[model samples]
Target: MELTDLATIRAVLKRHGFRFSKSLGQNFLTDPSVCPRMALACGADESKGVLEIGPGFGVLTKELSERAGRVVAVELDESLLPVLGETLDSCRNVEVVPGDVLKLDLAGLLKEKFGGMETAVCANLPYYITSPVLMRFLEERLPVASLTLMVQKEAARRLCAPPGSRDCGAVSVAVSYYARPKILFEVPRTSFYPQPNVDSAVIRLDVLPEPSVRVKNEKAFFALVRAAFGKRRKTVLNSISSGLGLEKSEILTALERAAVAPSARAEQLSIGQFAELSNRLEELKNEQ
Candidate 1:
C-alpha cells in the first residue's frame, strides 16, 4: 500500500470507518520524502531499536522498521490500532503499542521491547503536547540516544535556540541542559493529509551523557530557570526575586556571587550561569 498517497490513505481510512479527531491533532503525513529523512536523522539502523510516537497510518513506522532491528510505536488513539495493524502487517519488525507516550513507563517499555539494543526516538509529534512530551522524555532521562521530532517551525527555533539567545525560553534552557539540539530540516504544511495552518520542522536532539551543567539541586535549578524566564521583560534580578519569592537584596547578592550582572535579562544568561545562580540562591535559602 502507498501509505503516503492521499487517495490511498482516504480509501484505507474509509475501509476501516476511521475518522480524524481534531482534538488528537490527527494530521497524517502525506509527503513521501519526509519519513525517510526523519528515520535517517535519528540514525535508525539494524542494530538499533526505534520508539515512535503517534504513528499515523504507520508511514514512519514502516520506514523505521526497514532500518532498525525493531520498531515499537506508542499510539494514544485506540481507534488507529486496527488501522495500523492492517497497514503494518507486512512489517514483521514493527509493534504497535497502544498507549499514551506521556504516561507510559518508557524505561520499562524500552527494556522489555528492545532488550539491550541501542535505542532512538522518531515522531511527528502533535503541536499541542510537544513541550510536555519532550520534557517528559528528557526529564526522565530515558535510555534513548537521540530524538528526531517533527514540530511546529517556530517551536523548532525555540527548542534549538541557544540558551543565552533572545529566542531562548525556560523550555529551551531545559532542553539545552538535557541535550544538544539541532534543526535537521523543514516540512511544509502541504505534507499532511489534513493540512495545518503553519509549517513544520524536523529537529534532532542528541541526548547528553551528563547534564550540560551541574547544580547543587535539580529542583531549585529548574525553579530558578522558570522564574528567570517567567518575566522575560524584567531584569534577571527582578524576575528571579519575584518568581522565587526572594527579597531583591537576596537575589542581588546571589547574582553578584554568581558573577551575573543584576541588569541582565533571563535570555542573556547561559545554562552554566543559571546553574551557578541557582546554586548560590539555594545556599542563601539554606542559610536563612
Candidate 2:
C-alpha cells in the first residue's frame, strides 16, 4: 500500500476499485521524500494535531501520523476511504474523515478531534482550488498554529509577494494581515503522478497571535483593501474612489491623512498603509 511509485498507487487503486475523481483535484503525490519533508517543515510532533486536506492514498498521512499526536485527515472523495484505511491501518493516530473541506466547519472539527491541542495544516493542494483553500485556512478564521501547503509556484510567488511587485495583489495584502508567509521549498512537476504541467512550491505560514495591523472594524479594512486593488492598473485614488464610491477629493484627503504617497498604486502600498488608510477613512467619516 506504500505510495512510493505510480505502479503501487495504481495497484492500490485497482485493489480497492477506487476511481480517481478529477473534479476533486485528485493528483496524488508519487515522491517518496516530499511527505516526510513536509511533515518536518510543519513542525508536527507528538503534541500537535495535524489537519490534512486531500490525503489521497494516505502516503502523507502515514508520515504525519508518525510525527503528530493526532491527524484529522479530511478527504473529499469518499471512494478513497477504504484505500486510506488499508494504507494507514498501522497508524492509530490517524482519522480519515469524508467531507468537502470548503463546506466542513473547521472550528467544530478542531473541538471534536483536536480538543485543546494546537494544530498545523499540511496539504498537497489541488491546483484549481488552491487560492480558495489557502484563503479558507488563512483568512476564514481557522485557529491553526501554522499552515504548510504545496501550491502552484506562480501562486506561491503571488501569496508571499512583497509590495511594488507585479505579483502582489489583494491576496498578498489579506494573507499578510494574519500571518508571516514564506516559501519553504520548490517542487518539480515530476513529484506528482499524472504530472502537472507547471512547477509547484511548498510554503510555510506562521500564524500571528495578533493581526499585523490593529484597525477599528477589521472587516472594513479588508473591504477597503479589496476596493483599492480592484483595478490593478488604476491609480490608488481612482480605484478606491470608484470601488468604494467615495468622492475623489475625500479619497485624496484620506490617503494624505494616512501618510500614504499620493501617486502610490495599490500594488505599491504595504499592508500597514492599507490599515492606516482604513483608519483615516473612518476619521474622515467622523469629521463629516
Candidate 3:
C-alpha cells in the first residue's frame, strides 16, 4: 500500500477521518527509505518475532512484517486502528494491538504473542514518553533480544553515551548497565509527514544476558545511580550523601574504601566505580 507515500498517507487519513493528536506526539514517518532501514537495523529475520510500539499508519509494521516471523504492533491511538487496518491489510503476519504499552502486561504480552521465538522491539517512539518507555523496557526485563528505536537525536546521544561523557545521565547509566546502546543513523526532520522541530536518530540497544556491572543489591545500585546524577554539579559523595540521606563522613569513608575519589562528579565515575561505591556503602550500612 506504500504507507510512507505522503499522498497515500493523506488519502488514508482523510478517508478514515483521522486527525493527528499533538498531545500524543503523532508525527508519522513519510520517508519511504527510513522504515526499511530501521527494520534492517533491527536484524529481524524469519526466525525472530518483533514487538512494535506506536505503529503510526503501520509503515514500520509493514516493513517489520516482511522480515520478522511475527510482528505485534501496539498502538495507543484508537483512531488509527482503521487506518492501520487498511494500510496493513495484506500483511498476514502483523497483529495490531490497541493499548498503552506503558500500562500493558509486557511479559504476558511477549509470552502470548512471541513465545519460543527470539524477540526484538522496533519502534518510532513518541519523543515525550521516550525515557519512561525505555525505562519500562529495561526495568521489566522482557525477554526481547534487542530494541532498535527511533528517538530524538539528543536522547540517542544520551542513551549511548559513555559513563564519563558529558551527555551521560541517570538513564544513560541505567541503559549502559542493562544493554549495549549504539546510534545507527540520524533521521532528518523532513523524514516525517508533519516535520518535527528536532531531528531523530535510530538507536540499537542489544540487551545483555546480565548487567554490565555486578552489585549486591540491584535496588541499592539504582538508588545510588539516581542520587549520583540528581545534582549534576555536586560531587558524587555529596550528591549520594544528600540524595540518599547518608552521612557525608560515611559516604566519604565508603568512597575511599571503593577507591573512588571523593571529589569525583557523577559524570566522571564509571559504572564499575558506581557499583563499587554502592557495595561499600551497603556494607557500611550493614555494619552500623
Candidate 4:
C-alpha cells in the first residue's frame, strides 16, 4: 500500500471511521520522501531494532520495518490501532503497541522487543508533547543508540543549540548533557495531511555512552541547571541563589571557586562551566 498517498490515507481513515484528534496533535505525514529520510537518519538496518512513537497511518512504521530488523511502534490514540492494522498488514516486522510512550516502561519494552539488538528511536513527534517525550528518553538513559525526531522548526534550533548559544534553553542544556544533537533537515508545514502552521525539522540525537559532564549529584546537577535558567534576565549567581535558596555570598564564593564570572547569566555559561559551578557549590555546602 502507498501509505503516503493522500487518497489512500483518506480511504483507510474513512473505512475505519477514524477522525483526527486535535488534542493529540494529529498531523499525518503525506510526504513520501520524509519517512525514508527520517528512517535512514537513525541509521536503522537489519541488525537494529526501532522504537517508534505515534506511528500515524503507519507511514513511517512501514519505512522503518523495511529497513530495521524489528519495529515496535507505540500509538497513544487507540482509534488509530485499526487504521494501522490495515496499513501495516504486510509488514511482518512491525508491532503496534497501544499506549502513551511517556507512561510506558520503555526499558522493559525495549528489552522484551529488541533483546540484544542495537536499538534506536524514530518518530514524527507531536509538537505539544515534544520536550517531555524527548526528556523522558534522555533522562531514563535508555539503551537506544540514537533518536531521530521531527519537531517544530523553532524547537529544532533550541534542541540542537550549543549550551551557551543564544538559542539554548534549560531543556537544551539537559539534552546536550545526554546526547549530541544535530539538525538533519526541514519539513514544510504542507507535508502533512492536515497542514500545520509551523514548519518542522528533523533532528538526530546520538546518545553518549557517558554524560557530557559529570557532577557529584545528578539530581542536584539538574536542579542547579534549572535554577540557572529559571530567570533568564538575572545573573547566574543571583538566579542560583534565589532558585536554590542559598545565600548570595555563598553562591558568589562557589562561582569564584569555579572560575566563573559573577556577572554572567545562565545563557553565557557552557556545560563545562555549569558542571564546574555545580561541583564547587556542592563542595561549599559540604563545608557548612
Give the least accurate 10-residue stretch of model 3, judged by summed lDDT.
1-10
Q: Write the per-residue lDDT of candidate 3 for residues 78-162, one digit (tens) a residue.
A: 9999999999999999999999999999999999998899999999999999999988989889899999999999999999999
What tens-digit string does per-residue lDDT give for candidate 1 at 119-233? 9999999999899999998999989999999999999999999966778999999999999999999999999989998999999999999999999999999999999999999
Sequence-dependent TM-score of model 3: 0.98
All candidates: TM-score? 0.98, 0.96, 0.98, 0.98
lDDT of 2 by residue, 83-114 (tens): 98888889998999999888898889988999
What C-alpha lDDT values do all the predictions have?
0.93, 0.88, 0.94, 0.93
What C-alpha lDDT does candidate 3 achieve relative to the native structure?
Answer: 0.94
Taking the tens digit of each residue's C-alpha lDDT, what string does model 4 give over 42-96?
9999999999999989999999999999999999999999999999999999999
Q: Which stretches of model 3 miss by more than 4 angstroms? A: none
Residue 147 in model 1: shift from native, Å?
Answer: 0.6
* Candidate 1, run of 10 with poorest lDDT: 162-171
Deviation in Å, model 4, residue 38 alpha carbon: 0.8
